[model samples]
Each structure stands twice: as structure tokens, then as C-alpha cells.
Target: MSNSSKAVVSFIVGAAVGVAVGYFLNSDKKDELVEKLKDQKNRLKEKWNKRKDQLQDELENEFA
Candidate 1:
């Protein structure tokens, strides 16, 4: 293979190996991590929505 092709193959192999190792290492904690991330995302979204509503209400009251 050409040098560029060799590099591409090396990169793909390296990525696959890295993902496999990381997956194996984190398999047990994956669910817990995912749940925590989901909960955090929900909380942030809720806070943003509430702030947006409050701002909108203020703007309406000020101009009305």
C-alpha cells in the first residue's frame, strides 16, 4: 500500500482497538453514566426553559 493508505489503515485499526478496550473497561458503568448524563441534560433543559418563560413574561408585562 502507499504511505497514505498505510496511514489510513493504521488509523482505523488504532481507533477500533481503542474503542474495544474502552468499551470493555466501561461496560459495567455505561448504564450508570448514561443515566447520570440524561438526568443532567434534563435538569439543564428544564432550568433554561423556566428562565426563558420568566423572561418572556417580564417582557410582556413591561410592554403591555
Candidate 2:
């Protein structure tokens, strides 16, 4: 209903999907898959953080 609630729900859903994908990939490739996923996760975090920071800056500027 609220913005925070929607954000929380989105985070939970994203986490669930990530875990499921990791589990399946790990089952097939074991160590290699785990390493690949770790790299992907790090990249995803960096990209997401950059985008989020940019959006926040834009919003702050707009409001200021």
C-alpha cells in the first residue's frame, strides 16, 4: 500500500528469485556455478547501487 511496503515486497520477491536461480545453477555446476553467481551478484549490486544513487540525486535536486 505504502512506498516502504512496496519496496519491502519487491526486495523479498527479488531475493526469492535469486535464491532459486542460485540453487538450480549450483545443483548443475557446483563450484563453478557458485563462483559465476557470486560475480553476477556483485555486478548486479554495483549497477543497482549506481542507478539508485543517480535517481536519488535527481530526486533531491528536483525537490530542492
Candidate 3:
């Protein structure tokens, strides 16, 4: 497999391990974990939207 494929497999394995560990370790704090994850997802989405808009503007400027 290519380097990128290997990287993707490694990431998937790591994420699985992380989720399993988190689930086992925080059996009593599920609600808190869910809230934190939701907040993090919202922040990441906002950042991605801003970055996408910036890139779109740059592309339009370059071609206009």
C-alpha cells in the first residue's frame, strides 16, 4: 500500500483504540464527554467554514 493508505489505516486504528479507551475509562461521565465532543465539533465546523470561505475568495480573486 502507499504511504497515504498506511497513514489512513494507522489513523483509523488509533481512533478505534482511543474511542475504546475513552469509553472504558469514562463509563460514568458519558454525558460530559458527549457535551464536550459536541462543543469541539461545533468549533471545528466553524473553523472549517471560515477556511473554506477564505480559500473560495482567493480562488475567485485569482481567476477574476
Candidate 4:
């Protein structure tokens, strides 16, 4: 894409993210949103750790 096109796309994405953050900050359900985000974060961490352990075990078995 052209430079101007890239700039426009970036601006649009930034505006969309700003609107989302503004809505969440202003909404009455902010606490619920925070809880949901935290839960998602935890689940992602668990999945990451599990994958890392699996990779480590595989490497050990391959080399051992």
C-alpha cells in the first residue's frame, strides 16, 4: 500500500481502539470488564506455560 494509505489505516485503527477504551472507561460495567480481562489473561498464561513445558519435554526426549 501507499504511504498515505498506511497512514489512514493506522489512524482508523487508533481511533477505533480509542473509542473502545473510552467506552469501557465510561461504562458502568467497567468492573465486570476488568474481571473478564483478568480471567482471559490468566487463561492465556496457563496455556503458554503448558506449551512451554511440552516443548521442553519433547526436546529432552529427542536429545536424551
Query: What's the lDDT for candidate 1?
Result: 0.93
Q: Per lDDT, what order, best first? A: 4, 3, 1, 2
The residue pairs that clash in candidate 1, if any, are none
Clashes (backbone N, CA, C under 3 Å), per candidate, total 0, 0, 0, 0
The ten-residue window of minimal lDDT in model 4 covers 24-33
How far residue 22's Cα lies from its native spot in candidate 2, in Å, is: 12
Please write out the lDDT profile of model 2 over residues 1-64, one tens digit for every residue. 9999999999999999999888876686677877988999999999999999999999999999
What lDDT is reached at residue 19 by model 3?
Answer: 97
- List model 3 lDDT by residue over 1-64, tens digit each: 9999999999999999999988856898777777899999999999999999999999999999
TM-score for each prediction?
0.60, 0.55, 0.60, 0.79
Q: What tens digits encode model 1's per-residue C-alpha lDDT throughout 1-64?
A: 8999999999999999999879966799878877888999999999999999999999999999
Ranking 3 against 4 by TM-score, winner: 4
Among residues 3 or more apart in sequence or in different chains, the pairs in candidate 2 whose N, CA or C atoms overlap within 3 Å are: none
* Residue 4, model 1, lDDT: 100
Greater lDDT among 1 and 4 belongs to 4
Model 4, residue 23: displacement in angstroms? 1.1
